[model samples]
Target: MRPARALIDLDALRHNYRLARRLGGGKALAVIKADAYGHGAVRCAQALEGEADGFAVAFLEEALALREAGIAAPILLLEGVLAADELPLVAEHDLWMVVHAPWQVEALARATLPRPLDVWLKLDSGMHRVGIDAEAYATTWQRLRALPQVGGLVKMTHFSRADEPDHERTREQIDTFAAVTAGLPGETSLCNSPALLAWPQARGDWARAGLMLYGASPFAHGHAAGAQLQPVMTLESQVIAVRDLPAGEPVGYGGTFVAPRPTRVGVVAMGYADGYPQFAATGTPVAIDGRPGRLIGRVSMDMLTVDLTDHPDAGVGSRVELWGRQVAATEVVARSQTSAYRLLCGVKRVPLVSVGG
Candidate 1:
């Protein structure tokens, strides 16, 4: 078998969920959308089965998959029903929905279900993504509350700048959500991973832990002081070849990197085809035999070259970690001008091995 495989540490996943719960001080929904951000939703959900207060997904299909996996915990459809026809499936699966648009409100009002649906009313405080305007929030809330089909209601709004701790936008959003939903007869959820970590005040009735639940820091500035999260997925591969190139010799496509001195380059068995970032430039961090190394040239479809001069002992069969404990996904992506979320969710074609559930 190819030595390129992703090792998923389920223990770290559960630990992160527990940390999210501790920080939120309330019910926390493990955001398992995008196939649990490429960590495998079914496996991650099963790992957090009895631990997480609930699970949140981008759409109804994801919720259905979790339900099929026998996950009994509440599954929330973050985007809610896409069309009126999906209402029956929402009710049939007893899924919680996030009513973000007026059309969704209209659909719910027009349809009669076997059971009342629990809904989270979303307000577009500042994100301007997919939410009702603050001006329409109160009226929408009242209208949804009056609907016999609506069983429980929760006020929710997403933060656009919560990752930037110094930014005033998150604070403004929090205040706006408060002002719009004040005295409202329902629970509230405004914190995504970043808000829940940086702004304690943003934590409401339900905290949605997305990237953090996969054991990565949500802040661009790096891990918070007290919030130390263990990495859950370690992307590893073996060194398939090692070459000693003479000075002035070029490496990889485009000759992006030329040896300034006699350099030892180790070819790893994983690449963009396996979801490794293609634009990752020279000097991106990697680990050879658990020691530090730097990506030396352009990433190829099935291979990437790493500077193995410092680790002269590293050769064929040596372990190479693309990202995890030693080289963080956050660090690797930062060098590549991308986000950890993309790296995590973009992983495809690579086999996964789960450990320590």
Candidate 2:
């Protein structure tokens, strides 16, 4: 069996969800899209179903998978139906959907369903992504309201820069959403992980918990709220081999790192194939035998090399933490030049074992 595995602390996941709700002062939908950002959707949903206000996924298939797995909580389809043909299934499965573009609203107006679908009308609101333009937001809401197939409607928008905390752009986006949807009589969902953590004023009737639910801070810097998140997944492995190299010898592909002195390098059985970032630089952080260490070479597909010279007793079979507990995923993500969401979602080829649900 492979030595690498992801340890998912379901207790931490539940803790983060509760934190999001408390921070936003409203109901929170645990955003479990992309297989709970690759933490295994079925298992994650099972772990969270008991107390999650509901779960949110990117599309219909993900929602359907959860339903099949017996997740009876309200599930919102963040991207809505990809094609109009999916509307029937969306209706049949009792899925709520984000009706963003004109075609989705048009499809809703035309469809005759077994039941009215709960729809979230998404406003463009500075994200300039898949949403109805702000100028047309109210009219679109009215249009969806008139549809017999539409049941409850919620107003929603995504933040483009809430992670910055001090950025005026987030304020502008929030104002835009507020002004345009003024007088609209429906619940609002504006805060994602970052906004929920940083911008209290922007939190709406509902919050969407995504990256933070996995226990990684959404902000590049620290915050009181971000400090509350507990890491959920710990990617761990064992040292498979070690090399004693003299000063100036190059290491790994491209010889990106040259030994500055006599170096003891420990090889780890984890890499890009296991969802470790391939471009994570030589100085990236890792924890070997519960002590801090630094990666020392270009990451390989199935292995990476870490400097172990500081730990005289560490060698083959020493425990290595890629990210979790002793080594924060945020630190590794910052050093890798990637976001925590991407880092968490990129994990693959490693078995996931759960504890503390």
Candidate 3:
């Protein structure tokens, strides 16, 4: 097989985690969900174990996967208990759960366990997601507090748009969240990756960050490249074939790129199947032998051709970075009409091997 792969800079992972702590100025829970958002949960959790206070995932299976990998640190399930029968495994595994709905509360309130389960209550300050309303927030907190089946309860909520620092909606969310649990009990978690990095006010007793630790900017407007944040995952492939096409020769599917002039086209061993965005525009950037290059056709399921006529040194077996230190994944995501979060997590078949663990 080719060396096409995603090299993860784990040292940068620690730095980004610490960045969250530094910016938020509070306890931080590294949100390592979606397999650490495609960084591999076991691998990411190990890198983040000692540095972060804990890790939060979408549900129980992800937490259990980490446990299977011998990760003993705290892991919180952001989605909470998926079933009442699994509470034993949760308690046995020492995994914390988030209670978002009334049934989850009632399930815990009625279950008889060896002791109370560690849980966090989800508050719907805004976003209008799965969280309970303010009225329910107060009542459920009190009710869950009284239940011996539930252990320490933490307050948690998701941010709608912390990426856009100038957006007033985030301000409204912070204010509403503060108002909801102003005088209530236990620590609170409001900040995600963007909030942890930008909104100092959103930092609560605890914060759950998902993206920044991966070194990709969640900000849709611009990035703080001056802050010294480094990219974590570098996805690179190589040219498997190269051909000099005559003028007007179309390239790839549907002839998306009909060369205006004779051109040198190279097919790189990456496509949507390899996690490269299928919708990557014709002019989307790629890097060949450390030189800037551009994809010239539709991103196929297995391979995509890039226009490499400008690089005299470029040839078959040459290195090509889809996105990384050389080609920013954020920039590609922008050109692909998608977000880095989706692009990073959507990668398949490409192994994420650690570069600087």
Candidate 4:
């Protein structure tokens, strides 16, 4: 065995979900898209199946996988039907979907289905990515409302900068959403993980919990509410080899890090192949035998070196934590010049072990 594995704390997952529901001030759809941000969708869904209000995925296939796995909770297709041809499958699986574009609406109007499907009308409040324009929102809503396929409708929007708690754009988007859907008849779902944590005023009838549910703070800096999140994935490995290198010796590829002094470099059995960031700069945090350490040099595909000069007792076979409770994934993400979502979802080639469910 490689001695590299990701410890998944399902209890922490449940805690984060409850926290999202509490802070968002409504029922929440646990966003499990991208395989629960790469935590393994079926397993994550199973962990939350009992308590989750519902689950949301990026597309219909993801919803179908959940359905095949026997997840009976309401599943929403965030991206909705691709070509209206997916509508039959959507209805057959009792799936909900977000009708974001005009084409989606037209498709809904054209499709005859087994049963009426719950539809979420996404408004392009500020983010220009998708959704109906403000001017056309009401008309689009009317079109969808008149459709025999739509059983229920929910007003939805995405925040581009909710992670920045003090940003004015979030307020602007909130106002825009409120104004556009003022008289519309349906439940509202606006807040994502960051909005649910930072903008109370942006909270709607349902919150989409994503990154926060993985116990990683969405904000770049410390936040009062973000502090409550408990990291669910602990990426751990072991020191495979130890080197006592003299000063000025370069380590790893590109000679990126040179020993400032006599250094004890511990080779960890985890790397980019296992989803560790290849470009993670020197000084990225690592934990060795429960002691603080720093990653050194460029990361290799199968191994990464860590500074163990401070830990005289640390050597080969010492436990190493790439990121988890001890070394927060947020810190690793910040140092790696990546996002928590990417880092977590990028994890591969490593076995996942569930615990504390």
Candidate 5:
């Protein structure tokens, strides 16, 4: 059986971390959340352990998982606690929390803890997603800080349009973040990946890098050299079958892609089940037999077919790169009409061999 594989390049990951450090020019937290964007949290974190200032995850469970894995690095919980009960664990594990709501503030004020907690005050600069609005930020910060459980405070905000380098929204968010925490006595974190790469001004006291570490550009149309990144994960599969199709013969379920001419096709031993995207329509690119080809059918549950007419030498058992070094995830994301964040996080139920071959 063909084993669908994700070859994670630790060197690439480290290089990206270095890039973030150079560009951030300050403390940099690797956002190893989402299982390090489906690259495996424990492995990715362990690889970055010595070099990174800290690792940032979405919740306490993720932090605890890393801790249980012998990961001794400091962890920042970007989403903070969901329930009042999670507070003790947060304190016990020394996990930094991003207190964004009144309930959390109240809970922190109530929780009895042995050690003070570091807090990253999340201000709703513009996204208006999960953060406490700027107007109420100070009061909330003051309340959270008043708790004997609180240690140092840090201000943070997520960008709504940093991915679009030309969008004025990033500037607006920066201004709002600045205006809210102008003289506040705390460190500030503003940049995500795009900000860290493109908006030099967004690099504050710290930057939380997410997509960039996996070698995906946060800005649209940004290239590897332009963003100064390295490709971290390369997903590959093998062809299990090959056949010829007559002109106009429909391929795959629902006739998603009809052969334009007498075309050769190779069925790869990978599909949605192996983390290959399901909605990836025909014409999505793939590397077949070490050659570039196009996916020619609807992505199936167990496998997907690719056009091999362009590569006459392609055959069964040939290696196929769904997305990776040569066939960048950015390229896949563009063809799939999705983001690298989704693509990387979407990888599931597949054996990802980290440290590369």
Candidate 6:
């Protein structure tokens, strides 16, 4: 064994979902897209199946996987049906779809399904990535409402700056959404993880909980509204080798880190291939046998070196925590100039162990 593994705490995942529901002030859709943000979709969904109001994924295949896994909870497709052909599966699986574009509206109008499908009409409040413009929203709503195959219709919008509490753009988007869907019927969903945590007023009939459900804060500044959500995944490995390098010796490819003094360096069995950031600068945090240490060199394909000068007892076979309760994924990404989401989703090849469901 490589001694490298990701320990997923399902209890922490459940707690985070509950926290989202508590703060959302309405039904909470646990967003499990991107394979539950790399925590293993089926496993996480199974753990949350009992308590989640619904499970949300980005595609129809993801929903199908959950269905195949025997997940009976309502599954919402965040990206909705990519093609008209998927509408059948949507109805068959009783999945909720986010009708963002005009094509989806037309598709729904054209399709003759065995049963009516639930849909969320996405409004392009601010984010230009998806959804229809405000002007097209009401008309699209009318079109979808007229469709015989459309069942429950929910008004939905995504936040462009929900993570930035101080930003005014989120407020603008919320106002735009309210104004556009003012007289329209059906439930509404506007809050993402950040909005659910920081902007209580953004909550509607349904809130989408994504990153926060995994216990990593979505905010760029602090924890999830300082909520006591536990981290779900702990990336762990062990020191495979140790060396005492004298001053003037360089370490790793490009010698990015030179020993300022005689230093004890410990080689960890995890690296970029295992989801560790490749450009993680020197001084990035790591935990050795539960004690703090700093990364000392560039992350290699299969190993990373950590400065263990302060830990005289740390050597080969010592436990190392890449990120977890001790070193948050947030902190690690901050130093790496990336994000916790990328780090989490980048995890592959490493074995995953689920715990505390």
Q: Please write out the lDDT profile of model 2 over residues 188-293, one tens digit for every residue.
A: 9999999998898997899999999999998888889898999999999999999899999999999999999999999999999999999998888999999999
Tell me the TM-score of each prediction against the true structure: 0.98, 0.98, 0.97, 0.98, 0.96, 0.98
RMSD each, Å: 1.0, 1.0, 1.4, 0.9, 1.6, 1.0
> What is the lDDT for 340 in model 2?
91
Estimate, for each residue in 90-155, the C-alpha lDDT of model 1 and write its tens digit: 999999999999999999999979999999999999999999998899999999999999999999
Q: Which stretches of candidate 2 lie over 4 Å from their true place?
A: none
Model 6: lDDT to the true structure: 0.91
Worst 10 residues of 5 by lDDT: 218-227
lDDT of each structure?
0.92, 0.92, 0.85, 0.94, 0.87, 0.91
Which of 1 and 3 is the better model by lDDT?
A: 1
Lowest lDDT 10-residue stretch of candidate 6? 220-229
- The deviation in Å at residue 222 for candidate 6 is 1.6
List of clashing residue pairs for candidate 4: none
- lDDT at position 163, candidate 2: 92
Quote the lDDT for 15 in model 3. Answer: 82
Q: Which pairs clash inside model 1? A: none
Candidate 2 matches the true fold with a TM-score of: 0.98
Q: What would the per-residue lDDT of candidate 6 be over residues 25-78, giving only the tens digit for each residue?
A: 889999999999999999999998888999999999999999999999999998
List, residue by residue over 8-85, the lDDT tens digit for candidate 4: 999999999999999988899999999888788999999999999999999988999999999999999999988878
Better of 4 and 6 by lDDT: 4
Off by over 4 Å in 5: 223-226
lDDT value, residue 334 of candidate 6: 91
On a 0 to 100 scale, what is the lDDT of residue 163 in model 3? 83
Query: Which is the better candidate, 2 or 3, if ranked by lDDT?
Result: 2
Task: Residues 125-227, candidate 5: write the lDDT tens digits.
Answer: 9998999988898878778767788998999999988878788999999999889887778789998988888889887898898899988886668544345
